[model samples]
Target: MSNSASGMAVCDECKHKFQDLKAKRSFRFIVFKINEKVQQVVVDKVGQPGESYDDFTACLPADECRYAVFDFDFVTDENCQKSKIFFISWAPDTSRVRSKMLYASSKDRFKRELEGIQVELQATDPSEMSMDIVKARAL
Candidate 1:
């Protein structure tokens, strides 16, 4: 998406990669970061289909802000296998105020580029996006 009020444009590669994840299942998760110097959002890391949720979370810097989309697979109570696309905004408490504000302002526009996200999460810490919480939301 174009940088409007947020002053942060999402790079072309970021949108292309997100399409690969959504339509081709090329990735299990993707982590995005803002390049402050360029004032643009770019793909930071990607998780393969074999990677675990922990792997995805590990890509997030503990003291930074990031945007991520996770393709979560889970089994329903009826034993049906299901999957959900989760869009997560990760802004840890230790991150700088300017970074947090930038991420917050740019989140909606960034999320809109990755269509088909079924769930959304805003997390300041690991607990908020823990497996238990994600599983519950997937249900």
Candidate 2:
């Protein structure tokens, strides 16, 4: 599909495909907004199962920060095994608005890749349990 993050082509068919495949395989991805912005990201590869959030949060520049975190995992995986979590934050734009366009394009491309596997992605706001909640629900 078109990788233009400004409402990529996959957005049109992703929901339909997801609904069709939901019964066969439960593929879900969720987005969370951290309470504050992190100046830097600190993380380790392959965090321990069941303790990913702890490991992930520990990597932040501070315990409390505003950021967007994306989680991709299968619902059928009871233990959240093989789950992948992505944390992102905006950086100073030396390239002016060009970086924003690049990010949008990248996001659109990402959506297409996920649609290929029938994954449903949902973006939500930050809440009291932003970390714990995601840790509990994951994808």
| Candidate with best TM-score | 1
For model 2, the run of ten residues with the poorest summed lDDT: 33-42
Task: State the displacement of the C-alpha of residue 105, model 2, in Å, after optimal TM-score superposition.
Answer: 2.4
Compared with the true structure, what per-residue lDDT tens digits does model 1 show for residues 1-139?
A: 4658688998999989888988998999999999999999999999999999999998999999999999999999999999999999999999999999999999988888877899999999999999999999999
Q: State which candidate has the highest lDDT.
A: 1
Query: lDDT per prediction?
Result: 0.93, 0.36
Error of 2 at 18 (Å): 17
lDDT of 2 by residue, 66-126 (tens): 2233344545446545544443442223323643444434453443333333223232222
TM-score of each: 0.97, 0.30
Candidate 1: segments with Cα more than 4 A from true spot: none
The lowest-lDDT stretch of 10 consecutive residues in candidate 1 is 1-10
Clash pairs for candidate 1: none
